[model samples]
Target: KSKFGTDLNEVPREISFCSHTITGNKAHVVPDLSKDSRFVDHPLVVSGPLARFYAGVPLVTADGYGVGAVCVLDTVPREIAPAQLSGLEAIARQIMSHLNSRNLLESERQLSTQLSQSKRQLDDFFDLATDFLGICDINGHFIKISHSFLKVLGYSEREFIYKPFTDLLHPEDVEQTINGFISLESGVQLGLSNRLRAKNGRYVPLSWNLSSNVDGLVYAVARDMTKQYELEKNLIQAKEKAEAAASAKSRFLANMSHEIRTPMNGIIGMTSLLKGSIDDEVNIERLNIIQSSGDTLLELIDDILDFSKLEVDKIEIEKQALSVRETIQDVIGLLGTKASQKDIAVKYIQSKSVPAWILGDVTRFRQILLNLLSNALKFTERGSVEISSDATPTDDGQWTLTFAVKDTGIGISQENIAKLFTAFTQEDASTTRRFGGSGLGLAICKGLCEKMGGRIWVESYLGQGSCFTFTFNALETTASTEGRKKDPFAQIPTDLGSVKPLRILVAEDNRTNQIVISSLLKKVGYTPVLVFNGAEALELLEKECFDVILMDCHMPVLDGFQTSKAILQKFSDNRRPYIIALTASTQKVDIDLCFSSGMDGFLSKPITVNPLFTALDEVYSKIHDQVPSDRPIGIDKNVSLTRKQSKKQD
Candidate 1:
């Protein structure tokens, strides 16, 4: 043996003894390299730690390939023992086997790590998923269930495994669940919606999509529909409650209108009768004040009713031919007296481009103008109030007409202008007190303007003046007014002496209303047969023929609607009198009911002289086939009562 580092032990292949050993699949032993001709002068043999003897065995793999050699060398010449050399070969073979085993073990460890990571990812997905994911067998038994499925059902994994899927369903849903599974068996994908029973005995709605594979396994995903179902149910209930409240409100308004207008009819009617009989100018002025107050009260009631109708979107706009100029002029004329009293000048500026006739609701158009003009006059103490109208043609062959009511009135503040179109709201609390109004006029105008497919707005300074502007769309129409007659009430014929007399009957339940209506009929040159109720009127018709029956609704014994139907049934069309419903109810439904009951015409109360005369004039013209001529007419002497007698009856 020689003392040398491991680097010296590593010899070149040509000089190394082990290199020679690897040439054959066996051991090679040299007793003395100096004696061997092949390696006698080799570097290992001549070097500082010269090896004189050597022994080596080839490291052969199992495949019989000689890769490299294991060897031993010595400085002195020596011979290796045959047993020791055989043992060296055995050790080399063992080393090769160990290396192959280590490589196999390393490959197995890497594969195992990859498999573990994949399984963990799958577990996390199943645990974190919101949807219920599961697998079932052909028999509808749950084979595997995700954590989400177990959590929603409030069940343990053991409780769900191998359990029939239908067992977790609501009793009512079990049949459908089974049917849906059956459908899945036929290769048809199934969508199943049903309720599932939870651990607490509560049913939870679930919507599932399921499909079956060739391996007899059902893959399913489900969503809990509990929250969605609850929201839908709540929305439906809220809608029903809102509708019920609206219906209740409508009924209340109808009843209130009937109750209030019935008495208002009497107050207004009596005031009109009293004004006509008064002789003293001072007394007449007092009557005028009473009449004006009555009219104002009626207007307030109408405003509230109109606002209510608009709030519910119940008011309908009538599209008919109407003169824009005439409507504006009419409003200004009606408010002119008020303007004069307030020391305010009122005027109308009509643009030449403005259409003479357009399709719109005349009554509502007049109402808007009236509200703005009246509001202008009420707020203005001294300055002029002006109404101006202009028109622009739209692409749709319609005119977009803009109307502005400008007044040098107490102007609205910037903040107050926003609240002007809000119902029951004004510039301030003091505004309502100082200027007597319900504050619904502008609000009503806004609603009406929008309903006509237009808008309303205002421009003003706090201390200067206000200009309230509104626009509405209307189509220009060539409607003719050639055959239109003058207002019938403008000059009622005082006498029907030359013409056949109209046998008129008046049915009224209220005593005050009876006196008022009888007096109004007498003033119109007709002596009407006054009856307290519809039944009395019907009884009179049996004995005597009448041309007209002014039937008041809400009468005792039988109502006007019922009486009208009965009268129509009892008499032929030609023999039956023209039935006119005298109703205090101003609701469209009540008015519609009047016509539905076979009444020919409607007269809303408190019945004034003009409307009364107009109704009679229509009747007179229809019966005579011509307008009535001027003739001296007088009330029946028997029916006419003295002022003292009327006061006594009252």
Candidate 2:
């Protein structure tokens, strides 16, 4: 072909001689292009540039792709030497090697730029994070620390770097910190907490999470726990203070109850004794007034104590078989005097669905009815009060009984009904002034109803009477109702001539209480030996054998509990006297304590003729081996009759 120029550089592959060389792995040589059959019609030889001789070598890449060729062409036909073709192949390989190397260098430059940008982003993130981030060397030295770590310790980066990590720890925490680091080095992740000494010289609490790599460097994240620790400490202190206050309140209530009930018992007991002997109608009426006022005062004290017990969740519910109708009748009888004074009629209606006997807390049940009936009678000056009861059966074999007390008194307003059940609240300030009350009666009733698995509510309107309703859960029981209706004094003979003898002993420290108890026993044909205190009673017991010992709980010398326990230890079951506890305190805890101290029965004082006769009859029944008509409150009939022989010995 002609001399190489820019115009020939643009030849298309289909008519180009170099295209043939590029198709093979080696050089292509045409000694005479006109004589070669494959190139006989070649464009360059026929017209453009008549070439008689040609030689070319393929420019193959390292991966064996032939892109183009290096060639020599001449117009005159000539034979190509082997040496010449080898020289052309070497030139083609050298050109391919130079192109490959240049492309690789450009790619490496781009990669280096990307890596530099990534490193800058990581450094920015490390400095900007708020959490305390740090790295420690194998020796527990701070090799790297973030800005947050330096700021929290009040130290500059220069002062913290390369410093021992434990240097900032509280003296009490250094040993644990060292152990934690050692654990981290053994491929264990660690969670640690310690107090760190800050620049202000005050120790700051910190919580940390640490991990280690094979490079012997520890990576850590920490949080300042100063506020959290202080909060926890404050919460603990508050809880302790609350417990102390509660304990103090309980002690105060118990003391007040004992002090108040002691005088109340005397007032009521003496009034009862005075009434039995007086024949004048005016004097008897005056005595009744005195007894009624004393009962009102005692009820006020009970309300306060009950509310306090309920507030602290200390009131316990007792399950016993009780007659629903009898219990209601008893409550009605209790308020009957008040109703008579006001000239108001009191009625009770019982539905057939209400079982005769149901399992429940009889005392609390009576208390609820008493509170409701008392309120109704107090408000109704001239109208009638009605109490109705009905029961609904549940699928679980239990019964839900509902009782309602409707009064036609000075009716409550709609707004006042909302506040009726709240403690220390009444209809208004005028109501408190006119109708005196502690305003805790309804609240106590609510608390009692809930304790018995029930709820209480009221419905009323202005100028209309109010209706208070309550519901409780109970199980149907087949308990006998024979003795429950018997008169408590039925066994005591009116004429003392034919009375069975009982050797009774009364141990009371108070002079008035001793006289009142002795006179009551005498009235019932029982002549009891009297003593001043529990110690005196124990002394008398050592010298005499008595059938019954009525022990007062609180006295000057040895208390009744200690005296009872001593008696229990000194005498065998068959020889010990039938001990009965008499106390002014009516708390359940106190009653339980009485029984635990080996007393067979308990009686709350300001003793009256009925309960006093009941207790004596119970003791006599045990002695004579006859089942009395009624058992006294808190008497355990199942107590072994081994003590029966004590009376025979006496």
Candidate 3:
């Protein structure tokens, strides 16, 4: 508010309202007030009054509360008409109305101030958050943004505001940006994730949520997902690579099994023939050598099969009663010769507290012991190897069996220990050369231990010794099961009666195995009719009957599977011959082929007499009646069975 004035320092009491207030009259209203007696007589008004004639009305709050007044002043006052007074009064009322509006506006202004302060605090909090926050307009321009958005995006406030949201979008996500904004404008609340171009021009994966505010504003929050996305992608690629490698390995194993078994079959076969014909002492010693070679071949096959099972993660454990004392004896019996060869004392630390029979997977438990003992024997030269066990109760009322294998061998160094459990990795490359093994034993043991709800680890010192420890659940065996009879496979032969003579037919493409199989068969009174391949076997079946067909699955012309199928078709109703498929293919599908082609049994190569006999006994009844008087015989080294037997003999 301003006062009307005239000459320098002129003051008046009575002031004109309309003219002074509206036109900002400084001299006219003030000088008029100075001439008036009432105003002139007044001391303050007479003393060069800047306010000559003043008029004002009290301003009121919106709630009718009076706060202050607005006044209009002039320097002079003179006689005035009723119309002018009415005009003055009207102008006074108008001024009062303006004052009331100002009060209401002031109240609103205070409220606005408080709101602005609260919004700033909220903005500060959102800016401090790690997650990105932003506001965009209908035109896709950024209206507001948080500090994190700047930190994560490497942008400043001036750089971000009024900039199109799509300007920061990755080229691949441009369409997605357009779609998202279109959806927001169409009243759609969208939560999306994609890549965005950062200030550094690198694309970063981001996840975000967007919603419309009451004022038609879009609020968005985002999080950087670049690292997480990359990790998941790498994991998927790794999984695929592993699966492919495993598939290739399985195929290679199947092929190797076939290749090894073909030659082994001939060696064992020819040894059988030699046993029936030769009776010299020298021949007997030769027979022992042949049998030992066959055993070695069989052991190699077993290791490969075990490795295959471990590779595919299919080793299953079935719990049953097993004799601890007998298992220890069995391990000692099997590995004793190997230890003796190295002059290593191998023994078990038998505890009196150990139950004679315990419930566990006999096969797996035996395997564990075998792996540990084998490693000890291979690594140790002069010191003793000890296997011991201790039993305790767990918190869950289960028994815990802790087993340890301590060996005083060429101990593992710390460097080797770090990679000990990795497949195909030994203490050193020389370890593989010195100790012949695939280096998969410990890895297989670890996997088996984990599957059985346990863990295995080792402690060793270079040149001192090594101690391998593992824990497993100690299962309780019922008295009836504990005292159960030993399985037939577990029984050692007092005489050769357990070894049965076999009348077999071998269909294979390899020559050495045919000779081996022929000798081995003759020794055991197994009259084997040899065929070079599956096609020849089919032709032979038409003329002579065989007790069992040890049909090699991989062959030229008609495969073993097709021959088996043809044999079944030829005798669909009659007493079908027991067809035992012999192949190196250990894949489940390959094994299934035997069954699908009407095979009565399946024996994977290199076939040991144990599994072969088991299969024969399961399928054939007359196998025991045709025993030959001859003993085990030496295989002919020069005979290659791949040369057709029928033509060569003729």
Candidate 4:
């Protein structure tokens, strides 16, 4: 009564009804406190503000403790009702609940203020980061951006926050961003990479490291990659240009080979015929010199062509059944002439260990042997150059044929040996001057060995000599070596003079080539119908029945392809003559084109009498269905068929 709450400040606890109500189970009621002896001596009851009636209720807690009392006092005597007492008890319980709730709310407000301060500091740290940092909501809306984003993209936080993250993505990059977010999962690191639109209207490439899944917030560290992207694009363009240049160089070398070989073919072919006819030893020896010089030139051209092909990755190893013994013998025979000029002992020891036939790239096999032998001859002044072969069978039904070419040559130094196999590099500049070469022979051999699933290496001493060893993987074959090996290395059957004459037609544009071919045909006893171009040849074919036609691939008017197509279309299968291609090109593509254009036989020119007669005999025998009595064609005892004859194939 004296203050806001009803607590008697001066009342003695012994006399106050609240004190009694604290002990009582229900509200302690006194109809007249002044008339009752229980309160007559109380100061509050008999003195100032004396109470005549009093009603009190105990404020008991749920655990049964009476913490306080609720009381009503009246100056006049009154009666307490049960209803009013019960209502007072309910109000006391409600007040205790309100106090408890207020205390809890005050504690919570303090914690919330502390948390807000910490978050504000964290956000400031993110804004100060140098990397492009960002926070996005679970729905992919931009929530916060670092100051670095402003530096990188020229955009303020206010301009991007609350906008969909897709808004800044380049049109082409939107799908990638969407995919990255969709794949995002708890603890899974799915990185994001895309182009974002800058304020300057240019697309800026960015790489992002993101961690967002469980926190319902996307946290990302982004890096500017625009410069990196530009560099990569430039590098790709430079690579393309380099490849194009290499291709152009390869084509140039190929064209040069074709041009050179066309004339050299005539020289070699004529020398071969002259060597065959002359019985005088002196004259034959002179012709052999001319033949050797021509072959050396041809080999130089081959090396150039091979280097170009390898530089541009045009050459590939083709696997087929091959004669292992024949490969060694042929290589030895090929270099015998050069070795004989120096009087070096050239020996080939074929190990009885390897199979007679095996599957491998025969051309590459021969090439590797030839290269090593040539290197040996170039280095050695005298003594022996020896080649040997053996094979080890593997559990996988294959064999590793190992060949070693050991020579008594000026040996290579350890320091210089490593430099030998590098393209266009030799041991020293003097080595190049002493031995005229492209420096591609050993490199080409190494590449060939690798292409055949093997490797090449050398063991040598500074003065003792060098030995080159290489291995090739091959499958064992049951094929007979009889099909490959025969008596002569390079021979025309002298009995070719006995072949029955047949009607022939010749088409050539070059005057010198025309004369040479006609003279050779006359020497063989066949009078050939001659013409200058394909159009004239076609006119002759329409007017007469010819058993065979020697068609030149390239001529002035109506090239061979067009003429052949015209004749094949006009004539029936039975009436059409056997079309044989006579051209200078030795490339496989040119031969393939000839066959595709209806050619039945191919003979590369500066054709010797043997291959020329062999080509004629092949067509003649096939047409007549009878083996000719004179001799067989394409027979070489030492030559590996892996390197098919450049001049003839039926």
lDDT of each: 0.78, 0.81, 0.68, 0.76
**Candidate 1, 1-650: lDDT as tens digits:** 22233456355677667767888678888899988999877776676667787787787877888888777777889878778888987877787788679878999999999899988987787788899888888677887778987887899999888988687777888888888887887888899899878888888899999999998899888999999999999999999999899788777877777678778778888777776666789987787777768777777777777888898886778778888887787788767679888889888899999988999988789888888888888888888988999999999999999999999988889988888899988899998888767779999999999998999999998878899999999999976563333332335555642243678899888877888888776765678888988889889989998877888888889889999999878977557777777877666677767766877677777777766666665656555546322221111111111111000000
Q: Write the per-residue lDDT of candidate 3 for residues 84-121, one digit (tens) a residue.
A: 65565566567767776887899999999999999989
**What TM-score against the true fold does each predicted structure earn?**
0.70, 0.75, 0.61, 0.69
lDDT per residue as tens, model 2, 1-650: 22363256557778778888888767888889998898888887788667788898887888898877888888889988778777877887788887788878888888888888886876676699888888888677887778877787898888878988688888999999999988877899999999888788888888999999999999888988988888999999998898889777766877787778777778887787787676899998898789879987877777888898899887878778899998999899877877888899899999999999998888889989998888888887777999999999998899999999999888888777888889999999999999988889899999999988899998887667889999999999987554652433355576542376678888888887888788777776666899988889889989998878889888888889999999999988667788888877666677778877877778876676666766766676766657542333343332332222323334
Clashing residue pairs for model 1: none
Candidate 2 Cα lDDT to native: 0.81
Best prediction by TM-score: 2
For 1-650, candidate 4 gives per-residue lDDT tens digits of: 32333445656677667888888856788999888887788787778676788887777766787777777888889987778988877777786677567867987898899889988987888868877888887567878788888778887778878988788888888887887877665456667788888889888889998777677777888999988888999999999888788767655765676677678877886676676567899998898789878977877777777666666566666667788877777788878888999999988787788899887777678878888998999899989999888899888888888999999988989999888899888878888898877888899898888878889999998888999999988888877533542322134443344565567888878766677677677765668888989999888878897777888888878888778888788876557776777766555555656766766666766666656776787656755656432222232122122111122112
Clashes of 1: 0
**Higher-TM-score candidate among 1 and 4?**
1
Question: Order of all candidates by TM-score, from best down to worst?
Answer: 2, 1, 4, 3
lDDT of 2 at 81: 79
Better of 2 and 4 by TM-score: 2
The lDDT ranking, best first, is 2, 1, 4, 3
Alpha-carbon shift of residue 152 in model 4 (angstroms)? 4.3
**Stretches of candidate 1 above 4 Å error?**
1-119, 137-140, 146-152, 168-179, 182-192, 209-219, 271-288, 477-489, 494-507, 525-579, 592-601, 609-650
Model 2 Cα shift for residue 417 (angstroms): 4.2
